[model samples]
Target chain A: MTGLPEPLRSRLHPLDRTLDTLETPAVLIDADVADANLVRWQQRCDRAGVANRPHIKTHRSVAWALRQLELGAEGITVQTVGEAEIMADAGISDIFLTTNVLGEAKLARLGAVASRCSLSVVADSAEIVDAAAAAARAAGATITVLVECDTGGGRCGLADPAAIAALALRIAGSEGAKFGGLMTYPGAGKRLQTEQALQAAIAACRGTGLTVPAVSSGGSPDMWKDDGLEPLTEYRAGTYIYNDRALLSRGTATLDQCAMTVLATVVSRPTAGRAIIDAGSKALTSDLLGLDGYGLVLEHPDAVIYQLNEEHGLLDVSRCSAPPSVGDRVHVLPNHTCVVTNLFDRLFIVSGGRLQGALPVEARGRSI
Target chain B: MTGLPEPLRSRLHPLDRTLDTLETPAVLIDADVADANLVRWQQRCDRAGVANRPHIKTHRSVAWALRQLELGAEGITVQTVGEAEIMADAGISDIFLTTNVLGEAKLARLGAVASRCSLSVVADSAEIVDAAAAAARAAGATITVLVECDTGGGRCGLADPAAIAALALRIAGSEGAKFGGLMTYPGAGKRLQTEQALQAAIAACRGTGLTVPAVSSGGSPDMWKDDGLEPLTEYRAGTYIYNDRALLSRGTATLDQCAMTVLATVVSRPTAGRAIIDAGSKALTSDLLGLDGYGLVLEHPDAVIYQLNEEHGLLDVSRCSAPPSVGDRVHVLPNHTCVVTNLFDRLFIVSGGRLQGALPVEARGRSI
Candidate 1:
């Protein structure tokens, strides 16, 4: 075998100019939608006199975080030390870690990241505070520690206001550790509700006589109804940037404002009612049941993804007016945007059906 | 801060010694169990007089594939061009891509990979055959093309035998392509059924009037059955290396023989009956419903993972003998082994409570 010819290139036909031509199960992020979504949140926070610290955990891309900063975000919130490290490397100065820092190894890594930037993390227990303090001192870094309040999230944070204040005092008393303020993630169920509960929680924090200079409280679902944010100086809303099916269900963002989507191809039309796609658990992510399916078929909303294999995405096309053919590509908006972002290595940023830039999910698999 | 401290070395404890201390929702692959599983499959194939071509899609590790080859596997099988490329780079000689090769980019990639090894692929349609032939010619290499028959999989392959034979003839006539044999995946439903049905399907391939050099058939669920392999010269089986909940449910492998497990920590015991862990969709993977939960609690079988958040795994420990306390680590056998393997970047091979070697999931997240 000598003098080999060049391989065939996929001709960019006229029909391929549309979104339908791209490969199936590919992630799509509409920049316009994301931009509008970012602006809307910025406007809401501006009107409420609260700072917007959009969480980078939703996208895990420095480019997306920079876009948020460009749209008037004060800072950004990251969940892990790895995420903070990546963002700090990309020149993101302010970062708030919402999870508890545990273990000496993780705390040391967190301390190194905190030393590089204006990093602050939450401490729910005294043990976690001591660990953080030791790591911060060892690194010769002054790290801000936030007293995470359990505002019904039931995941982390102290339940009692006095306990939160005590943890804050413990961090303040420790060398190389400074008390930041209070932080809380109102459970998903209460995120869309009125701010009556959140206001009460803030009042309770004030009742403890602790100077809660910066109270961070915000979720995508109820960011619009944040009228009583006089207590919360900064709002950490992540999902508002790329609203998902959950946000849609909560009436937070319209379907068009959803920035991210999975582009999939109809690989098999097995039965009259069912068609199988190339996207499955490995692509779409098996994160559903409360919602109708894993995601909504953008062009064919009537079609439902009933079953999913590792490689085969089973779609029920019986309800559709026009079923997808053997080689038709479909767009899917995943139920959870954050989980979907972790599944891919890169994201294709397209505008007007043209390839713009390929953004890497810098913190794709930083689960630790 | 006058002097910055040196970067702390990663104190990542060995998996074997740290099994008791390692965080729960962790993945553990017992080398002993894996070796036994591999030897069992090898014995099954040897007794059936069929060459064992273990699919590396299950493990996606060269070390695991090499172990299978050492146990008497003829070669390896892959599903994607990316996966084939990884295996070829790892010095695997023979390979069979069991999926339809399509488009210019993928075909080109497949052709480049085919040139490096004894590569072949399955085709169900004329379009796929043309694409493969074009790629092979462009790469100045020949690739053996197998006509895929839809014995009942209903995902890919031609349903009719005449159509399969016709596609086989087309490949035989095409330049840079050779007609190999017939390939069919009998779907997951026929996996645990009697061997008579599989035997008939293998026998039906003989009547195609084409020289059947190989007849590949075998799934992890039915690896024990050998009567079906009488007419087949080769067996393609994956997932026996790491048995999962699905295989255990089908009585294919016992719990003791299952190699892979997820180690997780109980992060929140919010209520008396409900406990939440750190490993959720991001770690454990949400691939359940038909089986038990997403995974089986190795220590607490009675506990049920009722709900899974993006970062939290909610386990209902109401029926357990003793509920695990907060920070207690536990092992979970994922519902599906293949998807779990894709979730992690590295796997620590443990033997007798000691570290052996770390295997990188080289072809992980290579969905495209």
Candidate 2:
């Protein structure tokens, strides 16, 4: 009686109350699993002598961000200026924006947010560094700039060590900008190349009389396989807090360890093999992340969500002898729960099978 | 001159202001194109003598729904109870809920909203019909119930015409429910089967001495090619407002007719053939809808958005003769514009390439 757990005998408990009282298509954050996840990651980083700066995009709740801070996280990492502003408003002092800040409007916003908090951003190009420096000077604030190295990731970053060092030197030379360190997503399965690139970039920066104080590396898929560890001052990961199927499929996190689960009700059983649930692409989201189905049905492991409309999840239950009927509730572990957080307004918090309350997902869809 | 277009020559216009002043990763709705779409669809439905009940889920906007009503839309269609409540709250007199109402909480909500507006719902199961009737009776409201038919759509619906008529007869007999008509999504490329099912259902209902007033059909993919209109009293279409790449790929819509364009900035041109934009799965969404890439970059038709992280859209520009550089903006036609509406809080409205204002996507992510 797990995954889509059977209704508890005790109706007074919060979990049963949630299942019984709340409408379908609700996001439930199991506090026990989430708290354990937070503690486990923080301890791992502490053991490695590295600062754990959790990315807020996964949970996107100020309450969880504060909880991570209480667990002794060094700071917080944000991908957009809107996230930094929101987290800063909630008194999160140290913020690191991982995306390259481009354009005049965004640069001006970056400077404003920097003035409000101890802010640092990544830069892979000299033009970005110059623009940030200019914006910082105009706002009467000094910005800490990190050189983003491509390492093995095919996304944004300078692939060449010399270019990373040169960009670091350029930032260090700017009066309004201070060269902070190096940052990279470090494409998974290319550890040797990722480490080598960072080490070489550090030596190149040192050759130019630029001191590297902090080096950040991240990517949840390869976070736990720390064989020897890279030359990292800190590690940033968002999905560690509420593991999804992407982590589960990789054997990184077990089924019981996943904190967030989507609770949906079977709206129709059109055929013997098909059961349509209230949760759809808008609720669970369509981020497959290289998985087979949309999410994992806890009650029936054989069930596969073959398709989704805007408000319906089509589950092929042909293989399951005991399938969910109309009005039967099923708990689903979303393939990628990060996108799920941004899909809803609030998440139901459950502890000890009792509904504690709900926390608003305030930073959701803050794509500006 | 087109997508990801170069800055407009006239900066004083609202469209130019939106292009130059607004931040990247913004959703822009072209009024001229959108208005043309609305009028064209409305006129088509008028000529067919079918009521044009536009689905609000496409835009998830109250302003747009009101505009549609002003343009002679029979009534607005909603997929979820939350959408119905919101539209009803906006003084919308009539609302049709397409999804089946299951469970006590949602049924109670349905009855409450029915009390507020001329509310109707679709039901394929006897249990849903009974539960909704009981809820309506308790709330002192009569919910107009439409029998949902499968009609080749493998999702939620009663496939057999006799079963559809049985459900309609049951609703007609219920004191708290009224037999409104029949409804089906009518899965694309199955017109003959869809019409046959509807005609049979209507005959079965007539044999049962139940009057069928409305026979509603909807599906945006094959909407334009009406070989011969079905026996429908009303038609529903959502994506026709802001045509997307999915419609464009199928030749249902042309590139020039796409109204909703994601305006994103090129944050990094990491290599000669790769550029990263600020818009990712969160901004543009990952709904391929049988399309090739994430979106169609208007400026570089050959460029492909191969992959997406949370905040980065990776572009493969090796085949493009003139690729966009850093700080350059790109107007992207999303793979599916419906999901994109749910990803933003406010969509910027553009007229004559100028920023008219913004409409709150108030009904977005209302999967309740």
Candidate 3:
């Protein structure tokens, strides 16, 4: 073949205009709704006499994290050291990494970020504490360590309260480590058990003559019940800002309160009862948190995205009396907002049914 | 606090070095195995007297697409106009966009792409054909249109063979449009039915005095049985390049032939039978595809990743005779490799247990 012509640049119409002109398969975040959610959570935490530390993993935008901090959040919580690094580079001074930082290489990376920011991390074992301590010493940084206590969550954490205290004490005795407190991501709807577990861990720490600086417990499902847990000095929640179908199913937030949505266009209607959309597992995500479908279709409430390929959403329109036609736009509230945020590199900030600006997902794909 | 020291630059070590020093949650592709898969598939298609057009949606890497073309692939197939744009920019001449292009904006974008490359698309409806025709005429381009016939996939496609032929005739008669052929993504284990469906559609096209230039049928599960279908002159398969666990479960491929694996690290051991890895839904993807778990632990054959959060994979090691420890590196074979490729920004190309280079997933996040 001869020399080819100049290839056209496929640019998705910018969100600088109205939402009607924006492209499909785009992540649209209602900034007003997000701000309202932020203020509501802040006021709730203030009433409960607790600190509000929103997890940055939900949005992963430095701009949004700054907004949360401006809205009276004490600090930010990150899931990965990579996220902490990104936030610290953006001049954030306080960050709490909720995941356990193990391995010498990772702890060293964590120590580098902790040196610049008042960083605290959760550890469930003695090996993790020792690694963090050594890394902090090498960096000449004082690292705060929170012993992760597993109340009912079957994920990572120390189940024994005494073990948590022992780990905290180990942090206190280490060269460059300070015992911050206890932190637990409680199981869904296990508020009472989480409170009891944190209380026992705090008592065990007190018995060792170590004052726990902050006792943290978090889960969006039980965010409103923070006042019932007397020992928790702080609450960290990521999904509350961009509520999803999972939270909606739990009645934690109303559908109107959901801030994030996926804007998709009906590309094809193969059958009378089936419509294919531009968004699929890549755009909407495949996180089925015990919900009926992948997401909630806003335009056609009864329609279900029963299946998804990598690029096409299989919309089951059997339940919809009047289903969407090809070329119609639709909004999909994903089942889990956190995963959806990480799936896209940019999100369109929309408010009042108009486009604001695009926010880059700075910490997206920072899994390490 | 006093003025903090200079923040260390956070760098997830690049794949320029060996694979042994690579980071976790990294998508690693064995170049040798991938090239072998390319040659094997090409040879299989040649033996069956058909053209091989592997879908670039699997890897979404322009470099790999070029390599496939270099290995005797007739052309490449993409799932989106965004993908077609990227492939054309990389000097790829022939591209078959498998999804229907609808709406004025998308049709305009599709026409722009068609102007610079030999672009072909599949359509199941007359509206799609009319849109393509109008867009091509405006762009001064001749676009090839393929009628998509639904055999049993129940996704996007016309179920009626006569309807497919009618759409083909419309394309043949439309301004700046050419009737390319018929296309169908056969359902898993439904190759015979897909063949019958395509044969009927081709017959209908002939009855309408329109010659179907190319009859295409594809699916990774039924790729080996393509020779059984006599009417097909072209075959498209994507997942065959990077065989996933779902394909392995379907008995389409063995574990050794799987070219793609998510390299993760054991970050925590919460219980004796549970090890939490750094790779979660964001890294490994939660596409179960009706499998036992999220993915297969390649190191620990009996261990199952029973649960996953956005950033943590819960490993159930009860069935394993020997389990991995915290900080141990493990390779996970994702259930669906295509989605896994879209989740990451770059992939480490490994061969002979050493990192060769980094392949950018250029077409990733191009769902629009």
Candidate 4:
């Protein structure tokens, strides 16, 4: 849609029609499907009496993030200060940054955003808490600090509940900073451990005369079960809004629920058993996510994208009873959809098989 | 560089001199190292008496492409028509698009680029040739068409020599196109096979009264061996300019020759044996290239980036003799540098351990 010509615009079809309008290897967001996916996830949270705070990392579009907020999302979650700034610029008032915010540069930016919104960040160490407090004080803003408990994620967070409580107390005592609560995005099979760690940290903080205002826990695979985890005030899940092949493999969603897909054209058919698609690592992404192939070709489900160069996807069609030919467009569900969203500058929004419009990936490449 | 604050800009460091300025997870390009890499690759081609045409996909920076041309590169190879258009806008006249150009929309764009520059493209079938010729005729521009031969890559090309000749003859007979000989990016360890296939195709074309003028062949691994493939007038290599971990693993480049690296800060030291860097799949990329890890930790060569989320590189530092602590800046040589280049919006240019400036990845998401 960025450089799409007028003549080709008419041939663009979001449905299963011949994709002749837009160029091959385009990220197509089925608006109807995406809307349904969003509504379904939000409704599940609502039915369970829990707040659905969607993570903007899945879409990285300010428009869609605003849409989620409009759909009764309590707030939104982001991974970086840049993303939080983007959301703040879009007038999203309440935002929670899930990653540990460190460095004077990042903290200063976070403080600036905190001045304009109800901004909160996670911290697992006193060093980061002190840095955030100093930045917040310099900016004359109050920053909410959530102690990130490891809970068996084995990534980032305090492994011990005492460490988490100590960090929270340190944040409360630091200038221009307030203790928010505890947060953790645990591994797929560590939900119980994550809940236990959060509960233990909350009890320890309460014993020190500090109130745990919010408890945040989320992961798309365990999103539905988050409501069962006591003391979790909010749930944040990103990929549930646009279920991918990884989610589908985890039985989190079905193929029909995959809202975001890469529309690729078979550029070359070199052999009877093999074909090449224009969507390669650049489009589908190199995030294998332990999947066998790069993505699942929706048109020929049996086709295995066994190889990917920078701009070419090598499809082994030996398993497919009917393989695609050159010029035929196919839909690919990437193994991981979040990284795919970052790779594109724009997403062609389609509704019920028609190209509606395009949305800029506003927060894309805002990794820092 | 897009939204970086003035204070934060000075904090960026690729080495361990207290990374307080530019934020972590930045793409750092050492100017001296990059210039040396460029000159070294060019000299190798010059000494071999073959034209060096570096692929623009490696950096996708117009300024860098111009530098290659200024440093005596014959022409630059691009992976997309959009890239060629970008090069043309930058006053780069001679361009060869390595990928097969198809679809009316892309052909129209290709024609627009050809009208502004001396442009040639590869094709394995007559359909693409006819489409391209039609578009060229419509634009009143003469375009060169190269018959892409398989030559053991088995990706996108005509396998049979007779089939290659047929396509070459078709291009020669086309009204708005001229035959520009054969081109192939051969597979690893297939230089002899590529040479024989090219010879057979050339012989077949000559028997049909078509004179093949330029035989273009390339692969970074065998770039130095192109002179051995007789009649190969031009050589194209992408990764030699940056020299990723994949190239280093293959012994194609030494550590000193590697010019590009992602500078990341150790944001979380969760355990004694593990540290989490700010750079992840978004910065370092997930292209394993059959490597054991995501990237080579430059500061600690024994460190392995065992896991990566979107914005977190989980580094296994147990193998490191003196493991890095939180807030330490470390340079990462990504497994595939080209993909890493595509992920960032800007590259922080460095000269002798100091930040020089930032260069925009102008052609970052021109995947369409």
Candidate 5:
């Protein structure tokens, strides 16, 4: 990339600009790498005879979701009603709402989404089942309810298999709800415990005369560990589309497989041992994921991103043999890719090191 | 607030819906409390006889910025050219960009901002000054350059007074650039060191026959500690508009003074000792700021927000005598306020315990 002024340089390269020519603090999604990841994950799911329901929270782009569907994903998993609404409006017919919708205001929106598309939601309690059924009935929609099981995630789900079966029965008995299946966001490195929990929940549901059609369990850390022999019919993995530093550290993916990267410029060389990048917590996000630093500078492997402020990433380049200079552009692989998508409204798409058009993260900040 | 269904409840209150009626994972800014905070801080700055350049990073709203100016703010401090451009387009004439924009593409945008408003930027290196000066000259705009001093803020800025003085001289000698002043984001609890560094830089500038017009220093943690006795012409303070848990922990703000609160609903109660909220790192953000938990639940003070996923906030409520139930609404005072504004596209403006309207965070992700 020529270092000429922006307008002149853009005129010089009319078709596509390189990564360095793009604006700093920009999010780059290597389209080739992302497509390869999509195909690879789809092949694995296809081989296992299990449904691959890709989670849309990673990219949050309707275009990317469509691309995933084009690659043969069964249905997309949305964590919120807002995302479901967006995907449904975009003509995505099938969606699985992973998060439990309880509040009447939010459930009504979910009901509206269900009316627009084939929507299914998760519930861990009878209260949520009743509320969702009421909302669905009011909206004249049929909502499938997946009983969420606590498969060691410990966040939101019933740990007791009896409770899970009871919730499934309640949903089937409800006015506008249908008992669909079981879903569990398994904790990392707890595949055995997760399988046991799911097996117990399935058995309890069968005992209650309820047929659990689909059992879904997924997490990025355990993406490749699932042998499909577990009591699961579908898998939901979000971070596989754009693996991050955490996934790289786990050996789940390599640097070549990381689709998303934060392009930042060295704005300040404060000292010989210290350099400041324009991308900070606002751009890269403050998700450590048990890592020591916010992210890894792909160009300078020895340089450590030791600290981060709202708009400044402080790099401890003391150990680096050749530190970066001001205006030098660098790519950062964030610790968590999901939060990084939430941080930006749009991401710059790149392929073969050439800049492509920017895609808006339509589901960004759509937590509700 | 009423457990009565949504349509009935909304029809009951035709105009004003309470906080309970708002959607979960919503960011509510108490207008009254925010105005009180504005007035109180303005009064303090007024008494000190210093220019109050309130940083717009906290609210990222043009309406709030105009209100601050109406309440006698000298100017608004922006951290990026994108923010400056948004404020300048909104007719805010004076903007001080606290970040160092160095790259050609970004510097050109900063030049455009300079052409539109009274723009000033901080720089700690001659490379930045030279690049900014070239961009300014090319754009036919005059940009003010402030020599950034380390001043105990270990992130950016030069530590050596001689180097700062030399950079200031370069700014003064460069075309389309004027040496404005000395600026530093003083480290928390290092006021003396900051003052000494600033005093030395000031003296060095004087030695070089460069009379610093403005000696600006500011930080939220050190907001009240500045007695205006230190050599300074202006102070930049963000995060004071809506003091957060960090300030609350520092004894700088009380519970009644925090204007911003994340209104989330208890979605699930998987166990007797645990309840999950809809707001997580996405809505509330992951900025711990050395805090123990993600945030403080206002209603349930004993409830600890122990874990945060992208959309789930796990609360350890064993210590609480009265645990929350599903669909129960809760307000979370985040560990940091600045990052919350960046996470949302709009904020709910609440006044008199009623939801007034939603204000767009126009400069939310405007980081170049």
Candidate 6:
């Protein structure tokens, strides 16, 4: 389908130059560079002898996931049954749900997805395994279940290795559930300033075999710092495709390497130090990740978005050498990329001031 | 049409008791109570001799907008042309674009919407007025333009009455644009902690000889202190339907009056004081409104959400009288109500624990 509406077919007005002209608080992706980022990550995983299972939670675009597969990714990882359903409908064959499947509603959906694709999911409890087994049996399909272990993210996982093994054993013995392996996020280990912590996490995962064949440890920040990965068979990284402000702050990628940004315009200059942009919390979102302000201004890095209302972003320009006038377009790198991507229905792809095709955020509201 | 698929219906395990089995990180709305809240707001405007133009930006749902009209709302207020188009397509005849419509693409969309609906939009500049006029003429439509005056919000609007008059004149003389009266947000003035300050803003607007036909003023925190409504011919309030943590902090609504809450589950018990919930930046959002954390635990107000990752919310339960154990379900009132509504595709309507129906967030990502 043609992405651009007929009215927006002509080259956008010069006032809307760059991605900024598209409107304030609209998602902009540098298509040429984002594609390059995807290819680079796939190559890195291929060289490391690890399966490149790209996570779809970052961009939530079926088009992007297909591109990842075309660039040589083994499969795609989704966090929810709703997301997996979207990807499955888009013709993705191999899918991995990295989140725990709870309740009967989700398990039935999971079983349906398993029938359509090479499906695998993580489970932390025996009850969840039993539910998955019953749903898979009812659907006449078998699903691969991985035991999720707490590798220090402190989020969702089995607290101890014995608990993880017990869950894996339950899945193996279940009627329609097959034990795949173990999955660990190691979220804190990924964002470490040095590689020593990540190495330690790999060692810990290696020590806890419990008859598990494949060990999954993944995050984008340490994508390049892959040490002690000989014990792991697969790596899942989402943000490597579109490095954001938070990842950039951790020294993962440079500003130019960051592919996604919110293009916004100065709509109101109400005060000398303060100017309101068209994009507010609804557009840019309010995900402040221990950063100084809301986001980083691409044009005026010195300008700080001190506050954000529902439909207005307040840019503090007191420290700037020259204030941005009204109608000026500015690119803001959001603190958290995933949440911001979910806020927009489509993303405009641009390269060297040329507007590429638009891609829909297909899984934009798959919260369930 | 039924929102859920037929195959998924049998898997739905009805709550053991009414409202007892809801998992955390889920959105719950009391259908009967929410309907009452809508009726109450409509009644307030009916008695005050003002047009009740409810803002749909809060819920972003066509079903909810229709319900508001059924409850006697004259029209609806939207923040973007994209939203206006969605509402117009959904059979909402009247709409007010509450934000500045800039650029040719947005102005063109606005013009198209104006042709189909009783559409009006706010502008802070003569340039924007001309753009709107050009687009409206091309689309063979006429639009009423309101001069957005900066009261104390410092977001969008002209501070000077003369400048406002000039912009109004520009719209009045334009080919397809007509001058409507003035509009102001009164955002900063809402938290004045006294009724006298809010009255001062109304007096300032009346001081101008612009006739002041439609003096629209609203903010849920000061909705009850409507002493300033003597001059307001219309009111645009959004949050009175679903009170949030911010409104509760300002003493606008009690916990029971809060019709919306996020049901979340404790996914991980990493430590004693720290428990991770399935809801994170993706589910609850990261809107910390000058509070200690992102949201308030409805069941355990003392349990503070200290940190949030993409798919994990960290709860600091050290101060709680009784800490939430793993697998416990909790309800969280988000800091901002509008944002939470935008995050979900469907809202579960519940009353005394029985599942009423699922309402789709039809206009969830309608940000142009």
User: Against the true structure, candidate 3 has what lDDT?
Assistant: 0.85
In candidate 3, what are the lDDT values of residues B199-308, reduced to their tens digit?
88888999999888999877788788634567888889999998999999998888989999998888788889999998899888789999999999999989989989
lDDT of 4 by residue, A148-258 (tens): 888888889987777777888899899899988888888887777777777788888888888888888888987765435676788888998788999999888888888
- Deviating ranges (above 4 Å) for candidate 6: A1-25, A162-175, A189-210, A226-230, A351-353, B1-25, B165-175, B188-209, B270-274, B318-328, B351-353
* Residue range A1-368, candidate 6, lDDT tens digits: 13432222232222334443465567888766787788788888888889999999998988788888978888999987888999999899999988765655556778899999988888777756777788889899989888776666666676565556566667878999888887777764544422333334334444554356667767776777756565578888898788899889988888888988888887777667887788888887887777888889888888999888887888888888888887787888888788888887778877655665566788887866
lDDT of 2 by residue, B1-368 (tens): 23311111111122334468788789998877987898899999998888999998999888778878988999989999999988888899999999988877788888899887888888999988998888889889888899999988888899887888889889999999999999999888887888899999999999899889999998787788776467989988999999999998888899888999999988898899999999999998888887778999999999999998888899999999999988888988899999999988788877777677666887887889
Docking level for model 1: acceptable
Residue-pair clash count for candidate 5: 0
- Give candidate 3 regions above 4 Å deviation: A1-17, B1-17
- Pairs in clash, predicted candidate 5: none
* Model 5: DockQ vs. true structure: 0.73
What's the TM-score of chain A alone for every prediction?
A: 0.90, 0.94, 0.94, 0.93, 0.94, 0.89
Q: What is candidate 5's lDDT per residue for B317-344, written digit by digit as tens?
A: 9999999999888899999999999998
Pick out the ten consecutive residues of candidate 3 chain B with the lowest summed lDDT. Answer: B1-10
Model 2: how far residue A170 lies from native, Å: 0.8
Error (Å) of candidate 6 at residue A274 is 2.8
User: Which residues of candidate 4, in runs, are more than 4 Å off?
Assistant: A1-19, B1-20
TM-score of 5: 0.95
lDDT of 2 at B48: 83
Candidate 3's error at B231, in angstroms? Answer: 1.0
Judged by DockQ cut-offs, the docking class of candidate 4 is: medium
Give the alpha carbon lDDT tens digit for every residue of A1-368 in model 1: 01111110111112222453444457877766776788888898888788999988888887778778877889999877778888899898888887665544566788898788988887776766787788888888988988777677666566665666667778778998888888887776565332454455556656666566687876776777644455578898888878899888888788888988887776656467877777778888887737888788888889998887666778888999998876677888888888878878877666555655456788877766
Relative to the unseen true structure, what is the C-alpha lDDT of residue B279 in candidate 4, on a scale of 0 to 100? 90
User: RMSD of candidate 6 to the true fold?
Assistant: 5.4
Q: How many angstroms is residue A195 displaced in model 2 relative to the true structure, after the best TM-score fit?
A: 1.2
